[model samples]
Target: MLKTVRSVSIADYAKSGVLILPLLSSRKRKAEERRGKTVRKKGQERLLQGNEAIVEGALRAGCRFFAGYPITPATEISELLSVRLPKVDGTFIQMEDEIASLGAVIGASLAGVKSMTATSGPGFSLMQENLGFACIAEVPCVVVNVMRGGPSTGLPTSPSQSDVMQARWGTHGDHPMIVLCPSTIRECYDLTIKAFNLSEKYRNPVILLVDEVIAHMREKIILDGDKPIDIFTRVKPTVPPEWYIPYEDTPTGIPAMADFGEGYRYHVTGLTHDTRGFPTSRPDEVDAFIRRLFRKISQNFTDMQMGEVFQTEDAEVAVIAYGCVARSAKRAVIDARERGIRAGLLKLNTIWPFMRTQVEKILHTSGCVIVPEMNMGQISREVKRVNKGTAKVFTINKVDGTIITPQEILGKIREVC
Candidate 1:
């Protein structure tokens, strides 16, 4: 015989029956199911503008301090973060100019908060001096440069890859730099995270380059909130405040940073300084300081160098491009293959600390290489330097404040083949 089963509430026991508490009510159960769906849906794809993706990626990477001036193409980053940051207990400040913007970012980073700023070509030019200071201080921060045509405000509302060289070399002196070029909305998100990670890991400045087309264009990207991301954080001093040396020499070549208010007595200056953070003009100490700054990057070239090789295996003609131009070149490579041409494309995601090894590899495999840029062939100059007349290299350069087209790249490929 089956035993009888009865469901009773705790209230029934108080009245005169058994004390049985229900775990949940029908209303509560339904509410939980809806919440589960919302959480799962965050892992699905969403249509996002490129700058929006940058904002999302930065928050995902744990950036809590944002200081920047409003500029075309990249304005949405600061505007959106103004509203989003406070909700997460983060700080957002709009500076009077780009110069002040990067300054505040550096100050925030020194206080132990991950920081970033955004601007266009003109504003980027203004920040170069401060960028150099951050380099000497070894402060970690990210700068997002939305490429607009210009030497000095040529095309504020148009797209141009003219800032390629400036992103790497605009700052004064021979400072070590890391610049990332993202060609898609997904890359805009992914690379921004990588930029912050690199900055933190190396204790250096990192720049993420996008263009007007990339900044405003929309694309479907799965920025999965549930997915695990590889984030690198700045190493802090392990020793007590009395023993802390902000710029102490380490085997990894990266000095540990301490928060400003943590009672760590350390100096910070723009001048070439000794490990004690004090200015030293002695040849031995100056040489050591500069060498260590570059050594941090040189020692880790294997991990820092990044690029994508598409259809380059056994190809006769290869096109080297970055940013949105890479998109056109990708299509051109496919079109060339359709017409029975052995054409390939090398898309660079890391622009600086130039991929000499990878570029040489492509040069060896291909008879001819073409570099298409929206500038007057800045990167092509670097390619030619590495080629050194070993390969037939050509360039497709445009500086009329426009982007390179697939037809332009395909025509060059066909001609070369």
Candidate 2:
């Protein structure tokens, strides 16, 4: 009953004329246990930079193609993907410039791959044209813009949220966009996944806005290995190749996307096109195309809008903010509450289509809405527009490349209260 288990070499087994099947099986089981332990270790919680979290999130979302150029505060994303993407059988390309980066991404997405690209402010400016093209052509892709102090490469390493307006309206034409801003490292991961999902579901591009402060800063995060993430892939055409129309409008306003070389040969162009995907200069066709593009996003904004409200139910003063600046606002609200002031925070995780209903509710209920941002009141203007004389809107702005601290926001809360 006390038989000992010992390792036997292949040579020893052959010399002793013994069957080595049992010993080989034992070794295989031990090896598998060691591998399982290694995998578990790899999946355990660890500290991660925001940029690194973004790369992990994209990979988890089944992103198979990435094309981006080197840019500050965002180059790390491209670098990490270069190594990790190959491991997942994905492709990574360093394009000649930001324009080509987005072009390559659009091409890859058209080829039926979930693709993404990352850049900072300067590079972001360069990609606006193609961004609009992705919108008009109904190509689903994700673009990450890491904010840095900028107006033509102002400060590459410094944090600034000056691109809020640009993220919304940088392109030339009247197009709809969904922009998600994350306040923490964990949010950087979660929102990037959401960006991909929303883009695919809507058949348009989605922007993930990250500032320098969050992008480069390191923080510990608990990544739940058991949590299931909902992934949305583009709907493929069910009809035969001859019956497929790439731009066939549906009730949902999203057309079925057919991959190239899938027997569905359809045209795609940045110009206004018809259901068959051919360019049309007719005014009615152009009008219909534009309206459908806008309707797809504007009508479905309710499903796309996501926000967080803390202590807002009965508060007299509500603070509305987003991005990394919202972190300070949350702390300010908690501190104000401790000091017997009824203060709350409305954190906008989805910045575009502007949370009009939530802001209206907050304005009607609260005596005043205080918006503190790192930029010069870009979103505060939207808050004021939504408030519409119902409540006084106050903005606290800082654009000096420094983060808006909690104490600064608390002071504003005290003053407003």
Candidate 3:
């Protein structure tokens, strides 16, 4: 029997400090059964790990170069690419280390090849400096960080969401960053393609952040191989080689990129450069360069800051979550509704360049908002910042190399309501 939320009452839960678990109604049971049944799509449906789906997405998105070091949890990405890239006439290299891996990827992209690299926590840390170089150079490339428990290879194979802050701040200085989180196997494939498109369109390094759970989890998904997918490539300079300016700012703030050996001699550097790509120390030139990078992304928030809202139309309470933990949050929301609570959920797809406007609206509307993550309040902090006391903010943080359960989130909802 199903019960609508708060039907069991705060007083009832308070007496025992436990939410009464209700059996799913027949309708609910049928829905679960439908999800469990395998698809019968011919030549399209197959079981794949999240990491493997990413490789497929990359190939489909026209990724031709992959240079990476083998690291636990992320090793499959490199391993699979090595086999797949060759079949497609693409290039793949096992670099000496993470730093060199990104360096190679940067070089490949500069030569007009779509390139990428994958790494775990420690390797991600090592790539930070090189990643900063990519940002300043405005190189179009992709970096996949398969997060694992860590401070110093803390738990190489265990799951953890502690890298949320690191992904945004890992590189020394602030330029523009795009970090995406995928919660499902299908998203792993779709977002990887989207990541490549965004990188080429913006001529910037894009990070695809995947934790252990999603990276290794296996599920049935349709590859959609026959679908006509939209792909974006960097705009190349049509001007004569002698007239090309590699870093010239445009109305969209994205400059036309030229391949290194395309007969256009342009300097690429970590130093602040102007239109000619030559290092400039002039105050005005540096200011324009930095502002242009920020403008290209910030001005395009609608296309960049992506998220999904569930049951929020009439919701009085909401749960904000992302990555694998979002699955749990969704289940909790449905259960809350069954128990007669008007609860909702918001799952963030873009981690950085936070979705502030949508979050602010939810904060203003909901009586209370709960943010549950694998890290200790990393995203919750952002929610609270946007809150401004519009709604009471609560957090359910877990960082013990384990996941936060739906039951755990329900308990918090029960207590708060």
TM-score of each: 0.90, 0.89, 0.90
Error of 2 at 358 (Å): 0.7
The TM-score between candidate 1 and the true structure equals 0.90
- Any runs in candidate 1 off by more than 4 Å, and if so which? 1-43
Query: Which residue runs does candidate 2 get wrong by more than 4 Å?
Result: 1-43
lDDT of each: 0.86, 0.86, 0.86
Per-residue lDDT tens digits of candidate 1, residues 1-417?
Answer: 111112122232122111122344557756865775323233256778999999999999999999999889899999999999999999999999999999999999999999999999999999999999989999999999999999787897799999888988899898999998888888889889999999999999999989888899887776667567699999888888888777877888998888898889788999899988999999998988899999999888777777777778868999989888988887787778778898888888889888888899889889699999998998999999999777999999998877788999999998877
Lowest summed lDDT window (length 10), candidate 3 = 13-22
**What's the number of clashes in each of the models?**
0, 0, 7
